[model samples]
Target: MTNEELKKAALDYHEFPRPGKLGIEITKGFSTPEELSLAYTPGVAEPVLAIQANPEDAYRYTAKGNLVAVISNGTAVLGLGDCGALAGKPVMEGKAVLFKKFADIDVFDIEVDAKEPKDFIDTVARIAPTFGGINLEDIAAPSCFEIEDALIERLDIPVFHDDQHGTAIVLCAGLINALELVGKKIEDVRIVCLGAGAAGIASMRLAVDLGARRENMLLVDRKGVIHRDRDDFSKLNKEKLEFASAASAERRSLAGALAGADVFIGVSGPGLMKPEWLMLMAENPLIFALSNPVPEILPEAAWSVRKDLIMATGRSDYPNQVNNVLCFPFIFRGALDVRARTINSAMKVAAVKAIAELAKQPVPQEVLAAYRKNSLSFGPDYIIPKPIDPRLRDIVAPAVARAAVDSGAARLPYPAHYPV
Candidate 1:
């Protein structure tokens, strides 16, 4: 498509509508007085009494089983930072529509105008009863962590921030395949991240939680490496101290961290990693230049430095795209299916493994013939399964649901219809 076409499409997406993508539709005819009584007046009171006697009956009597609240403060909408709550409505609406389209989960998009963490948490907590799960989206990092932690501690329903954990889980899946392709083990390798934002911090957390050595990670931010000597560590920054370890004292610049690093993950802005930086990495390095729209280092440049490098990016036009869409839909589907109380490290690890295994599975003859392509085996270019793959929901959701149950965080037992 031409640039003009792209611009027109963007305008049409917002201009052609009543400024929203979803609306409530009644299931029953409400033209008659009897229908109105059953829908809102007398019949609704029956379920209210049942819930008053047994709180769990709310799930049975109401829409709680399928309702998910997509809450946003609009502070961090995609690559656009701090767009405010009202401006964030379109993305929230889009997300709500996807929840319905993908997993049959009903969604209510709420744009909270409050900016303070306390206000946001308290507001969402007060209305927690209206949803089976709360999806916190587009809230700025650092603060997003606090809001999620507060709500999860106070509310019974599951609270998930799709930005941090969802992105981390999918990146881990790609890293799993990329490591295997390059004959590297995560435990023995050095990993360097170029951003200390939400996605970078969460990726580091998941890496260590899933078995990467603490001493092997070096986190870089705007003021260079986030080390112990930097006396400006925030509360959330201090929370990631365990991942810094001895490397905190050793490494200084991005170049210093990449000297012998086996993996390079860029969550920061564009054009950060140059050929010199890529060349400094260890032999057969795995690179995830995940900066959206434009990557830190383009795949061709990384490959130019080392032919053995396994490269991935956030753009769908690129090979081995590390998109979070691969994670959130399936992860939430699994969590919602079993009524998970919270998404924990065990569930995240299970999701990572499930996604890795999907791409690792040998392609069937029919699948190959359909694509008219070969060499689609589990390798550098095919490490993580793409979003359009049919097997994703079937494979990842059941594993996550089982993990949630095993971890003692699931509110509902495994459903009978969960596909193996």
Candidate 2:
């Protein structure tokens, strides 16, 4: 569709149905006065008292177990940066729709107009009790780090900043399969991650957890490659500093950094990854140019340079799309089901493995029908599972839940409702 036509359609979609994308739907009936009394006044008091006596009873009596809060400050709204919190409501509501549709989790899209990290942290901690999990969205970088860290420390619920770990998990999932296809080990491969924002830093860190060596990673931002000799460690955020590479003088620039690199991950903007740089990458290299609408380098351009490349993007049109939707909904599903306190590295790794492994299995007929494809095989192009696959809920969720339980992050046992 043309840009204008697409804009009109999107606006119409949000307007014609109602004022917004979300609405409150009562799960229980209360049509009669008797039902109303049972739903609210007298009967509600019993559950309230029970929950007051035993805090754990809130999970049994209320929707807290199934509810997640999609909170945002809109400071770092993707595709449109620094839009205010009020402007970010639509995006937050869209997230809620994904949560409910994908994993049967309810959500309240919260747009907080806090000016600083302290205010946002205070607000979220105060409202923490209302949710089983908190999905932080679209907040700007260093402050996002601060807010998420403080809230996770304060709240006993599963708190995740989707822009960071969600992208990281799915990226790792695809990366795992991509490396397997190329017959290379993650630990031995060199990876150059462009854009040292939340997604870049998080993906690189998670890659390290999955066996990628810290010394093998070259993180680049707008200025240049984040080398150890840059003398800017004090200026870098704690998250970004973890990735500073103590590389030789030749690796100080983006071009030099991509020299024989096995993986080139671009969370930066469009066209920043020159086609020439692709030639410098190792044989059978992987490229994740994940900027939305336009990637770091277009696939057509990259393909012209090298046919031995496995490329991924954030667009739906691409074969291996690194999407956050594939991670957050089901991760929360598993975390909530098992009453996990935090979404730790083990659970994230389980999600990565589950997503990667799912792509290897023969495509189910239902999934094939959804994609309008006869088959999807485990290969360079089809590395990550499609976000629409119903199996992700059953497969990824149980994997994460199992990991949570095994790693002592879960308060409850492995849920019987989930598949064995």
lDDT of 1: 0.85
lDDT of 1 by residue, 1-420 (tens): 999999999878877666568988776779999989988988889989999999999888888877899999999998899999999999998888877776667899999999999999999999999998998999987888888889989988888888888889999999877888778888999999988878888899999887898778888888777676666655435555655544444567788889999999999999999887877878989898999889999988877778978889999877788877777777788998898888889999999999999998876666566556665788878788776666778888899999999999898898789864
Model 1 misplaced stretches (Cα beyond 4 Å): 28-34, 231-236, 248-250, 362-375
Clashing pairs in 1: none
The 0-to-1 C-alpha lDDT of every candidate, in the order given, reads 0.85, 0.92
Q: Model 2, 89-191: lDDT tens per residue?
A: 9999999999999999999999999859999999999999999999999999888888888998999999999999999999999999999999999999999
The reply for model 2, stretches above 4 Å from the true place, is none
Question: Considering every candidate listed, which one attains the maximal lDDT?
Answer: 2
